[model samples]
Target: MKKSILKWCMLAFLLISNLAVFAQGGTEDTPEPGDGTEPIDSKLIWLAIIGIAFAFLYFANKRKAVRA
Candidate 1:
């Protein structure tokens, strides 16, 4: 039980750190064609994606429990 909790904590930390690392916008002066100077906030999109992932995991676990 303790090991499982520790593993989950580690996983959460790693995932959050990774997302932070990637979320950093480019430091260059010139923006790409489609991309503008302003950063597009995708908080809603991220929430939706995370929600979907959790929903999938929840349903999958429920299915396995039903089978067992």
Candidate 2:
């Protein structure tokens, strides 16, 4: 039992130390308006939403049909 406890303590210490080493420093630069990034298309988002709604309705109808 004592050996198991020691092993867990060592593991926790290594994990915490590695987290500090991997931590990132702050960046100085920030983006401004019209940074030449293309705007996202709204049509694609609507298509995805409609497709998911249809899929859920299709599955629910199928389940209801099976029960009847």
List the RMSD of every prediction in angstroms.
5.1, 11.1
Best by TM-score: 2
lDDT of 2 by residue, 1-68 (tens): 99999999999999999999998687686557578643457468888999999999999999999999
Q: In candidate 1, what are the lDDT values of residues 1-68, reduced to their tens digit? A: 99999999999999999999889666656766666555557467988999999999999999999999
Error of 1 at 12 (Å): 32
Instruction: Name the lDDT of candidate 1.
Output: 0.86
